[model samples]
Target: MKYVIILGDGMADEPIEELGGKTPLEYARTPVMDDLAGRSEVGLACTIPQGMKPGSDTANLAVLGCNPRQYYTGRSPLEALSIGVDMKEGDIAIRTNLVTLSEEEEAYEDKRILDHSSDEISTEDAAVLLEAVRKELEEDAYHFYVGTSYRHLLIWSKGSVTELTPPHDVLGQRAGDHLPAEEKLRAMQKKSYEILSKHPINLERKAKGLNPANSCWFWGAGTRPSLPSFEGKYHKKGAMISAVDLLKGIAVGTGMANIHVEGANGGLHTNYEGKAQAAADALLKDGFDFVYVHVEAPDEMGHQGSVEKKVQAIEYLDERVICPIREALDKAKEPYRLLVLPDHPTPIRVRTHTSDPIPYLLYDSEKELRRIGAYNEREARISGILVEQGYELIRKLFEN
Candidate 1:
């Protein structure tokens, strides 16, 4: 039997007053999801382990049946794998985000972090900006590599993992309040601002009213990572389709194929239809038994705290991604088990990841289950089927 997982990253949310006291999933137009819920096993799964930080690194590991408490090294290490960074034993990998800082303040510390993703700046432009930083700051000990849009990597030789706050977590807050405790790391950040704030790119972006990627914010530090083979454990070759480096890195570590779709940027205007078609091709034509499709738009909109955009993102996932993949499988007369869920909740209210149990829908093509309400948080909760151990949910999908 073929298997598919459509992961809408950070799609879960709390009730928003602007959304008429309904979560985005509830408020959005998801007719395809609602139809699938009628014959699917709908429930909740706690993707984040207790006391663990509610980052996608931990949550996605749990969803893929790898216990985060055991396999998760850090977020950047996974992204490092995607970037093909051959990390050494004592080397450290840190996520270097091209973030936007308020330019009105003279002191670097006083500037607020205006945008974690610098308005989702193009990778081409970001690469140029990173090159400037690399020329001035990179040395024998520290090296820089550009990843996807706004996301980059920094490999520090013999560096220790330092406590650094994610820029997204403290949006609209003073940069100094959340700077890394390590003096060297903090100094690098200040230097990055000086280099980028007045760069030609920033001036051009300012002219166009775009958020200038004015500084580098480092976080998600870790050493090398080792993950068990996914095919060995599950006995099925799997593939991953995602725009983000973090998810691609997990695929690299687990020995799964990372299917890259052209134009698939991890933003609201990402290539959703391309991702759906890629997953269908991997399963139908490529002989892969399982495919994991991840969409990052909803989570990004949540981080921006836009209720309307978050709802629109969910609608796109339903109509653009989920509907096409399911139609292709059915047309091919394939007996498939499809699972749809989120890794964690980047609640619009909080604008950060939360360790909340997310709603899931498991649909079997050959069997029809008792009808459930719409595929959403409230209905999933009412179903009363809670998977306390999120890592085991994949087992249930494969074995059942």
Candidate 2:
């Protein structure tokens, strides 16, 4: 049987009183998910283990059945792999975000972090900004590589993974409090601001009332990654469809094919229909054993604390992605086992990833479980089926 996983990143959320006390998933019209939940084995899975930060890097690894405790190297290394950057053992990979800081007459540290994603600046514009940073900051050791949107990469030859805060984690906080303690990294960051703040591009963005990607904030650093081959472990020829480099990097390191869909940006307006079509083609036309489709919009909206947009994103996932793929599989007579879930909760309250137990649904086309409740956190919790080891949950999809 073929296998599929439609991962809605950061879809899970705590109940919001504004939405009639219902979470986004609870309020969103997810008819396909509701119907699938009726015939699917629904329950909660702890995708993030205790003592581990609830970054998508660790959580998605668990969803794919790779124990993060053993396999995860660092978040940036995975994105580096996705970018085809061959890193040596001593090379440290760090994620660099072109962020926006409030303009004020205080110390650089006193500037409040206005935006982590620089208002989700276009990659085309971000590339120009990064090029400026590279010319000004590149040295014998540290070099910058342009990635998608505000998310970029930096390779520090024989560098250290010192303490640095994720930009998203400290939204609206004083920049000084979270700046890297390491002198060299801090110096580079300061230089990046100087290089970008007055660039012609920032002036253009300012004129248009857009958040200028004024500063470079770095985090999620680590050495090179070495993951066990997914084919060797699962014996399935798998493919990954995602716009995020981190997921693509994981697929690359694990030897899974990366299916790039045109117009598939990892944002609210990302090409949802294109991603669904790609997964269907990879499974039916290409004859892959498994396909994983990850949608990043929901998580992104959650991080922005935009409940309305998060609900809209969930609706698009159910309609544009899930419904089309399900119909394609059915029409093609491709009997498949499908699993649907979020990597973790980016609760609106905190606007960041949390270690809370997210819900999961596993549907076997051959033998319908026909269980209770819709596909959501509350309903899944009511099922009372908890998978303590989230990494083992993928095995359930392949099991007979």
Q: Pick by lDDT: which candidate is best?
A: 1
lDDT agreement of model 2 with the native: 0.93
Q: How close is candidate 2 to the true structure, as a TM-score?
A: 0.99
- Per-residue lDDT over 201-296 for candidate 2, one digit per residue giving the tens place of the 0 to 100 score: 999999999999999999999988889899999999999999999999999999999999999989999999999999999999997999999999
lDDT of 1 by residue, 131-244 (tens): 999999999999999999999999999999988899999999988899999888899999999999999999999999999999999999998999989999999999999999
In Å, residue 134's CA in model 2 sits off its true spot by: 0.4
For each candidate in turn, give its C-alpha RMSD to the true structure in angstroms. 0.7, 0.8
The TM-scores, one per candidate, come to 0.99, 0.99
| Native-to-model Cα distance after best TM-score fit, residue 62 in candidate 1, in Å | 0.7
